[model samples]
Target: MAIKSFQGARKQQSDTSEDAPFKVSDIMCKDLITFKPEQSVEEVIETLINKKISGGPVVNDNNELIGIISEGDCLKQISESRYYNMPMENDNVEKRMVKDVETIDGNMNVFDAANKFLESKRRRFPIVVNGKLVGQISQKDILKAAISLKGHTWDK
Candidate 1:
């Protein structure tokens, strides 16, 4: 008599669906905390603390992407204020924000976005479309995406 097997044949691992979303837009946070160039640095600091965010993109009144401001930038202002004995109230987002901003396209692959983070050493990347700030993707977002995609074979 042949030995009986308790387990049945297992199904082969399937590839992720062709339509599966793997782009930055799919994983990025659309409801973003943004700033304005003329906004007071003190206001930015307060919002950053209240929202528990490190930084955000600065936009124009027309909602166009202008620059990025971070906690580090705020700190720089604070430091300068202390060093020069100047009033923090005079500082604004435009003076503190990094104007030469690097943004990511919404359609880029999440994996590619991860590489960009590594290359740029950025904590977050603003997503822009048609010169407007649309959303942001963070290192935390990439980590969340990776964990959510676990157990699946990556296409690349």
Candidate 2:
């Protein structure tokens, strides 16, 4: 049998006719950590620290996304509250969570996802499907993807 040439092999590998366009679902992390609306800020903070996540979507009992909480939101608590003898019960995620949330469909393209992130004030966004929370996409995730794709043929 004749051996295939290196150039022929390279050409075959480069052919992407069957390749699908990149979508948010393809890159988004599906194993999402979510917080409940009734959960205290302290509990949420513990989850964040344990997971090493900047933030996550807050969902109601029905698993519908209600808001998003981030490290920024946590910091807001300290900055806004007075240092007087305040009760731990005074701290709650709902009080500090950004209720006005912006979200994207999982099927969105990476370009559109990145655009939405840039246009919005929120650094993290919840990925939804049919109004249900599925995953989270953050600035860090976008930056990671950008760096991973650097100097690659896909950059063209």
Off by over 4 Å in 2: 1-21, 147-152
Give the TM-score comparing model 2 with the true structure, all chains together.
0.75
lDDT of each: 0.91, 0.75
Number of the predicted model whose TM-score against the real structure is largest: 1
Ten-residue region with minimum lDDT total, candidate 1: 12-21
Deviation (Å) of 61 in candidate 2: 1.4
lDDT of 2 by residue, 1-156 (tens): 998676633432353323433567766777888888778887887898998988888888878888988888887776666555565557888887888888877777777788888787667777877778888777677777666665444522
Off by over 4 Å in 1: 1-15, 18-20
Model 1, TM vs. native = 0.88
- In angstroms, the error of model 2 at 14 is 3.1
Model 1: per-residue Cα lDDT over 54-130, one tens digit each: 99999999889899999999999999999999999999999999999988889899999999999999999898888
TM-score, one value per model: 0.88, 0.75
The true-structure Cα RMSD of candidate 2 reads 5.8
